[model samples]
Target: MKNPCIRVLATGGTIAGKAGSATRHDYRPGQIGIDDLLSEAESLGMAVTLSGVQIANIGSEDIGPAVWSPLHAATVAAVADPAVDGVIITHGTDTVEETALLLDLTLPTAKPVVMVGAMRPADAVGSDGLRNLANAVRVASDPGAAGRGVLVVMGDRVFAARDVRKVRTRGTDAFRGFPRESIGLVTPSALDWFGAPWRMGEAARFVWPDQWPEVPVLPIWAGIEPDYVTRLTGPDTRGVVVAGVGEGNMPEPVRQVLRELAVRGVAVVRASRIDEGLVDREPEDDANGFLAARALNPPKARILLQLMLASGVSVRAAMQAEFDRR
Candidate 1:
């Protein structure tokens, strides 16, 4: 059988970072380029033809619509190419989940799209970038990986994009899949599957606007004020996601503000700030005109809301169905 061909899209992150000293704490992200990363991956002797494109050279924290627009277009185009069997994205771990979720929502291909990142700098002792990159290529080449939407490969664990989140700041085991175990695991010999495949709604191509709608995420904390909610009522503010306390609860004052925003046609979504759990609809939430985000974290919920609003879909019904999907 012919070896699968993979196109790697590299975005700057720790995997491409370079520290001045191996024992130093400070390092510069994106100092290394995609060509070098791929060259190292090739040394692993994986049975695949690897190619790379430099999408961006910055940490994930700097990732936004400017990067997302082109990245999405590039990914869609790459997967559509007959020569490319799968796509792999090298991203920074800081916000890798957000990027993965965005791609998962947008990409329509059955071919694999795997996102890989490293917690340590490329030049650091025991750096994991090469191994993670090799594992990502392996997963992408596997036929079983098709139809699984976007998968995040880190520390030998494969997580569905929708369920994966960065849990730690500095560790090889920085990502975790919530509400359940990882869908697959990467071994030295092959990728192993232990869970059923899952995917989001069919890809809906979106035209990149000059500016994406301004949707802000507000966290609920003790003594939180409703002043910020009022600011979100500005014309430029299209939507808001409340990272509320347990079970997606917000203060009464903030709830009132959200009700006001909803009355004015601004979409409001309720998501838990906690790592894992379901946000079911409650009477008060309904009365306040808030949509429950179900199992989605605040950041992911924000992305979904942005896409739904941008596509002219009914936010309430769409979000409810997304959460209720099997």
Candidate 2:
């Protein structure tokens, strides 16, 4: 039997690497294109019909809106083809989470969009490209994986694009579930998720935060008193995401300032410092109108807070609910 059709979109990373003296055969992005990745795919025995499509030859860390636009367009277009069963993306681990989140919000596709990256470079002695890429191909072609939304398949865990994170800086299992926890790691680079299964809602769209006020993620760490919170506010700042302690608990002192910011219409959403659990909404009587995020870590809470602020969800309850849905 013929393998399913899976398009491997090479944005370039350790997966498409060649001997680069820059980092000393240290594996770098841009040394090859989709063709090189696809060539390796065949050698790895992934028999899926592969098309080499290159989005960028640069590191995923250095990638942003300038490159994401074209890649997003390509992903949107590729999913429309009946012959294409799925799509795999080779990305840099640094910003893979951001890209995954960007695609989750911007693209409308039921077909699985798998984002794959490697910790060690391809030219290294024990590179993980072959394994990571192979894992991505399995996810991209699985009907069960489609529309679970964009996924980051690495380190033997398949994580929802929005739920995954680079927890270990230099491990093969670089990305995985956070505080919310995952259903399971079916493959080395995949994590299971539960939601409205395998369907891309047509309602998703990108309203850039450029016009919206800036939303900064002000993390409150132990003993580093938050004098910066006072100066963190911007003229156009719409809100802030406080990366607080477990269950969104902030220092007793900082809570006062955060509440004050909320009073001035600067939305403050609380996330957890713990890997598990979420920020409980302010109690009915203690309701300072601060919203709570769904186990969103500091960075992504910023993404959600910024999106809500940008889209003008004025009520704290509504903002909280919006994040829960995401």
> For this target, which candidate reaches the highest TM-score against the unseen true structure?
1
What lDDT does the true structure give each of the candidates? 0.85, 0.73
Candidate 2, overall lDDT? 0.73
Per-residue alpha-carbon lDDT of model 1 for 1-326, expressed as tens digits? 89999999999999999997887778889998989988888888888999999999999999988898889889989988999999999999999999998888778847899999998898888888888888899899987887778889999999988889988888799889876568998954688998655543345344444556789998889998899777645788888888999999988888888899888888888999998857888987667778888888999988888877877766576667775551
Where is the poorest 10-residue window by lDDT in model 1? Answer: 199-208
lDDT (tens digit, per residue) of candidate 2 on 192-293: 545445454453555554553577777777875656787877767788887777777777677777777788888888887676656666673146767778
TM agreement with the true structure for every prediction? 0.95, 0.84
Clashes of 1: 0
For candidate 1, give the lDDT: 0.85
